[model samples]
Target: MKALVLAGGSGTRLRPITHTSAKQLVPVANKPVLFFGLEAIAECGIQDVGIIVGETAAEIMAAVGDGSAHGLRVTYIQQEQPLGLAHAVLIARDFLGDDDFVMYLGDNFIVGGIGGQVADFTASRPAAQILLTHVPNPCDFGVAELDEAGRVIALEEKPAKPKSDFALVGVYLFSAAVHEAVRAVQPSWRGELEITDAIQWLIDQGQDVRSTVIDGYWKDTGNVTDMLEVNRSVLETVEPVVLGEVDTDSELVGRVSVGEGARISGSRIVGPVMIGDGTEVTGSYVGPSTSIGDDCVIRDSEIEFSIVLPHSSILGVRRIEASLIGRRVEVTPCLRVPATHRLVLGDHSKVQISS
Candidate 1:
C-alpha cells in the first residue's frame, strides 16, 4: 500500500502567518506539523508516497524534496485549485493506482501515531476506514451518525444540527474501492467535492465502511488557538535534556530541553520548556509550555505558554503569553511615557476596540 498525504489548502484561519508560509509547515515543538505525518507514514513501511500540494507548491517542494530523508520516495501531485478532499483523490488516481492507500491530512496532529490503525486496516481490509473522535463542536467538522449497532449509517459535512459528537479525524484508510466512490459523488452545496460525501456514497452503496473511535489525543491544527493547544499538549511530554550552556547565574527548574549552542545566562527557566539550538536567553523568565525556536533571542522578557518561531527576538518586553510569533519577527519595548490612561488616536481599515 502507498500513502497519499494532503498538504494543500489555503490556511486563512492562520492569517498573516499563512499568508507567507504553508499551514502544514507550522512548527509544533520546533518541528513542522507535516513532518510528523510523513514520519508516521514512513514508520508504517510505506515508501511510495504522493503528496497533494496547492498554490504554495513550491514552498512544500522546497521543504520536502525526494522524501528520501524520511525513507520514502515522494511524488508531488499539484492541484491547481483545492476543489475538495475527494478532488485530491480524483487527481491522484494514477499515483495511487490499484493499491490501497492511507490519506493523511498534513496539519492534523494525532498522538500515539497511526501504527495500530494501519495494522488494523491491513487485517480487516475494509473498503474505507475513518478515525473518529468526540469533539465539543461537531458542526465545525464532518460528523458521522451511528446506528443502534454503532455502525456509521449516515455522514454529513459540517451539519447545522449534528446527529453525533463524533468528528472525523484527519487520517483515513481506503482501498481501490474509493476510486469508484469518488466518481459517484457530485460536488456539495459548497461547490467542493468533500471526502465526507465520497465516504457517504460508499455507505449508501453497502460498501464496507468502518470507523475507529480514537480515545487518545487528536487535534486538527487549523487555526491559531488549536495550534497553540497542540503545542502545549506536545510539550507536556518533553523530556528534560540540557546540552547547551547555562551560566551559574541562571537557574533551571523542572523539565526543560536546552539544545546545543543555546546559552542561558542570568535567567530562570522553568520547564516543560524548549530552548532551541543557537538561541540565547538572558535575564528572562521562560515559563512552562513554551517553545522557543532555533536561533532566537529572548532578552529581558517574560514569556509563558507561547510559541516563538525561528530567528525571532523579544527584547525588553515585560510579558508575553498565549501568543504565536512568526519567524524573523521583532518585538521590542515601546518608547512612551507611562500613564494610567493615555489618549491614543488611530486610523484603520477595520477596527474593533473594547474600552
Candidate 2:
C-alpha cells in the first residue's frame, strides 16, 4: 500500500503566516505538523508515499527531501491548483496505480495516529474507510450520515443542513476502486471536485464504505485557534528536559522541554511549555501551553497559551495570552508619553483620547 499526503491547499485562514509559509509546515511543539503525519504513515509500514504539493511545493520538498528520515520513499506530485481532494486523487492516478492508499490531510492532527484504521483497511480491503468525530459544528466539515446498522449511507460536503454531527476527519482509506469513483463524479457547485462526492459515488454503487468515530483528540490546524490548541495538546505530553542552561536565579516547573543552547535566567517558566534551541528567556513569566521557537528572546514579559515563532522577541510586555506571534516579530511596550490609546490598525494609524 501507498500513502498520499495532501500539502497543496492554500491556507487562506492562516493569513499572513500562510502567506509566508505553508500551513502544513506550521509547528505544533517546535515540530511541523506535517512531520507528525509523515511519521505516522511510516509507523503504519507504508513506504511508498506520494505528497501532493502546490505553491509551497519547494518548501515542503526541502523540508521532506527523500522522506528517508521517516522510513518512506516520497514522490512529489505537483498540483497546479488545489481543486479539491478528488482532484488530487485524479492527478495522482499514476503514482497510486492499482493499489490501496491512505489519504491524509497535511494539516490535520489526530492524537492517536491512523494505525488502527490502516490495519483494518489492509485486513479487509474495503472500498473506502473514513475516520469521523462528533463535532458541534457539522456544517463546517464534510459530514457522514450512517444508517441504523452503523453503515455509511451518505456523505455531504459542508452542508448547510447537516445530516449528522459526525464530521469527517482528515484521514481516509481507499482501495484501487477510488480511482474509478473519482472519474465518475462531477464537480460540485463550488467548482471543485469534492472527495465527499466520490465517496458518495462509491456508496451508491453498493461498495463497502466503512466509518469509524474517533473519540480521541483530532483537529485541523488550518487556522490560528486550532493551531494554538493543537500546540497545547502536544505540549501536554512533553517531558521536562533541560538540554540548555538555566541559571540559579530562574525556576523551571512541570513538563518543560528546554532545547539545546537555550538559556533561562531570572525567569519562572511553568509546566507544559517548550523553549526552542538558542532562545533566551530572562525575567519573564512563561506560562503553560506556550511554545517559544528557536532564537527567540523573551524579557520582562508574561505569555501563556500562545505560540511565538522563531527569531521573535517580546520585551517589556506586561502580559500576552491566546496569541500567535509570527516569525521575526518584535513586541515591545508602546512607550509613547501619556499613553493615549494608540493603535495602528489596517491602513490607518490613530491615537484616540478619552476624557
Top-scoring candidate (TM-score)? 2
User: Model 2: what TM-score?
Assistant: 0.94
Stretches off by above 4 angstroms in model 2 are 336-355
Report the C-alpha lDDT of model 2 over 88-150, residue by residue, as the tens digit.
999999999999999999999998788998998899998999999999999999999998999
lDDT of 1 by residue, 1-355 (tens): 9999999999888877787789999888898999999999999989999999998899999999999999999999999998999999999999999999999999999888999999999999999999999999999999999888889999999999999999999999999999998998899999999999999999988999999999999999998788888988888999999999999999999889999999999999998899999999999999888999999999987888888888888777766777778887777666552222111111111111111
lDDT per model, in order?
A: 0.89, 0.89
**Which parts of model 1 are misplaced by more than 4 Å?**
335-355
User: Please, what is the TM-score per model?
Assistant: 0.94, 0.94
- How close to the true structure is residue 331 of candidate 2, measured as C-alpha lDDT? 71
Candidate 1 displacement at residue 81 in angstroms:
0.4
* RMSD values, in order shown: 4.3, 3.6
Clashing pairs in 1: none
